[model samples]
Target: MKVTLERNHLLKSLGHVHRVVERRNTYPILANVLMSATGDGLDLRATDLDIEVTETVPAMTATPGTTTVPAHTLYEIVRKLSDGADVVLETDGNDQMLISSGRSRFHLACLNPDGFPDLKSGAFTHTFAIKVQTLKDLIERTQFAISNEETRYYLNGIFVHTVDGPDGVVMRAVATDGHRLARVEAEAPQGSAGMPGIIIPRKTVAEVLKLLDGVEDEVKVELSDTKIRFTLGGVILLSKLIEGSFPDYERVTPKNNDKALVVDRDSLARAVDRVSTIASERGGKAVKLALTPGQLELSVTNPDHGTANEELAVEFDLEGFEIGFNARYLLEIIAQIRTENATFMFNDAGSPTLVREDGETKALFVLMPMRV
Candidate 1:
């Protein structure tokens, strides 16, 4: 195959697709990117066994054919070339690739394109179209809480499904790592009535978010029982759905906690960050929280090290209590809180505490209190 593609456009497409390729592979072709030159343009594709990404860019197709070349090596060569240079790629009879531009040249060992595992855009039974902003919001809101432990394979990705809520149909995304839980919901988009509740792998979620940055038009999505597909302008991504069942998250949310403590988000974040500096140097990453009549105090102490405490005036009522929590976790959840004031509801120091936006009911965070 022979083709001529603009250097920067090729680099951009490679940058987007190559992250999915594994560095060291048991299979030879999995390390390569599939380049297809048609009469109009060239298509670049890369995949691990679980996720696949494809991007099309304009190129002059001198000879129409398909071949596989090392994904990372090609990207590096093009990246180091002159800024506005054009890249010419051709394959020799012995399965080697020749890449040339200006004074630099490269010959990379090529693999048989037929050896790559099948990336089928299988017939999808359901398809829907939604605004790109809607999809981005859903991911950003709840992706932080996804579990990283490998034992509970089901909890590794966000649970995205439609459910019946008090108001009507709502689209929901939920994630939990056994210690903290984050749930977000919004009005369902136009044609997702019968869409299945699926667990999108964590890596796929990150990749999709990256792809959305360049696209302003609507995204067309298609899914089946085992796989899902996304189509944006001139690009497509396919991913395998996680196989296990997610735990029932509804039973975990607290029904009632009368103690309502409202604290400013920015102030709380700053205080927690400062106090945690002392606590983190010790162990357990635990910090103490005390809420009294007029002021709230954050303190952390380690017998071997030192201590830290900060006071802030907060809105609170009823009795006083003390609790401990992972300082980093609290800071992350607070960062996601967009409202001016965030409310914390606690039953006691030992039980799981509930956090919500000052007046919003649709999104809430549940955190298991830690012992310092």
Candidate 2:
């Protein structure tokens, strides 16, 4: 196989798909990217058994053929080459791929393209198009809550589905890690009302986010019972659905928490950061929040580090109450709030707390209190 492509174009295409290649692979071919050169352009494909990404870039095809080369190694070589330089790729009889730039050349071992796993494209039961910004918002607001634990595999990704909102049907994304939960809603795209709820794995969510970054055009999404595909620009991403049921998240969202405390998001985040400095070094030290009529005081105590406290004025008129929370968890949720004010609804010191932006009901957070 032989092809010539602009340095920037080759680098961009490789960058998009190389991330899907797993660093540690038991199979040799799984670590390489399959490259197919045609008269039109070049096709690059990479996969990690579960998720696969393919991208096509315009190139000058010298000879229409196919070969496989190490994804990361080739990407790094192309990245270091002088910008705007034309890169030539060809495979020799010795089963090695030759890479050449203006004044540099390298040969990498090539594997037979026949060993590369074929990604089966199945019929999609549902298909729709969504605005890039809307989908990006849903992911950015909730992805941080996805669980990293492997035992509870169901909680390892964001739950995406359609739900009834105040105005009408809307697309919602929810994620929880047992300690904190985040839910964000956006208007459902046309013809997506009957889409089946799917659990998008954590790694797939990350890849999708990266693909959506800075993309203003609409993204096409197709889904089936066992697989999902996203197509945007010149790239197509196919991922296997997580074969597990997510928990009933609505049951855990408190509906009877009456006490309300409205405070500036930045102010509360800063206070939490200051007080947690003296907190336990192990678990992000628990910080105690004492709420009164118009004042909120945050304090932390650690036998080995010392103690710290900070006070901030807030809009609370309920009876005084104190609650304990992990400092790191609190900051993570607060960082998602874009509005100036954040509202917290609490039932008691031991019960889970509900948080939201002051006047927005489209997004909500539930955080379980910690014992100080």
Candidate 3:
């Protein structure tokens, strides 16, 4: 395609889609981004079979056409160009795309646009609009708990659905990796009622987070049984939904954990970090939390490393008990808490522990204890 675009604008658009291009692809066209130039602007599309991202940038069309070029290579070239420089992209007859900016020039091998796979978007059965910050909050609160194990494919994404929350209906996002679970809910937005539950894959969630990083505008979401689409500003992301049933997460959440301990979130997180420093480096080392009337002690021991112990004043009325937990898990959950105190509810030393912000019911974290 023959078009001239500002260097920064072209680079930003390329950054959005190039991430979806697979580094090693069986099909040559899959490694390239489809660039189409029209009188209005330039359209850039990239995909990795399961997910597709498209971005549009205003450009001056010299000779309107379409071509496919290496996504990463083109991005790197544009990124290195001087700021504010006008970038010119045109196809040469010898199956190559020429990129020029000021004194810099590069020729990249091009593929036929026809060879690029079409990103199939199914008709959406449900469509909703949500505030960018609300969606981002749901992801940040639970995404850390998504499983990385390939065998349990269903656990590799956040389970999103409508739930009867404490305050009327709300949209809930839950994720668990068997060791720890995170559940966060937000007030349901307009047109979200009766939407079917969907599992958004980890990769797609990452991409969506990137798109909404600094954006505060509302994002339009369209979904079907097998596909999901997100439109924000001038960008469009379409992803295939994971076709598996998520576990019944409600059953895993402890219902009657009575023992309560309230500790400053920062203090607890710092204590865990300090104690875990001397913990075993192999498996996520376990930290022992000893809770008494109004004091909590965190301790860790490793054969190779030394031992660490820290005491923090907390608000606990339960009888003294000790529980073992993965230090890393505690830190991750603590990072999600935005309030001053992190409340912990425990049934026993061997049972799962429930954690949440003090006096907050919209977000909760459950962590399975580890044997010390």
Q: Which stretches of candidate 2 lie over 4 Å from their true place?
A: none
For model 1 the TM-score comes to 0.97
What CA RMSD would candidate 3 show? Answer: 1.1
lDDT of 2 by residue, 94-151 (tens): 3899999998999999999989997787898999999998989899999999999999
lDDT of 1 by residue, 1-372 (tens): 789989999998998889899999988789999988899888899999899999888999998888899999888898899987999988865389899897878999988887877777677877888788878878887888999998998999988888888888888889999999998888877777668888999999999999999899689988887788989777789999898788999888888778899999999999999988867645778989998987899999977678999999999867788999998889878977879999999898988889888899778899999888
lDDT of 2: 0.92
- Residue 366 error, candidate 1, Å: 1.1
Q: Which stretches of candidate 1 lie over 4 Å from their true place?
A: none
TM-score versus the correct structure, for each prediction: 0.97, 0.98, 0.98
lDDT score of residue 47 within candidate 3: 96
| lDDT of candidate model 3 versus the reference | 0.92
For candidate 3, lDDT tens digit of each residue in 138-227? Answer: 999999999999999999999999977567889999999999999999999888888889999999999999989746679999999899
Error of 1 at 120 (Å): 2.6
List runs of model 3 lying over 4 Å from the truth. Answer: none
Better of 1 and 2 by lDDT: 2
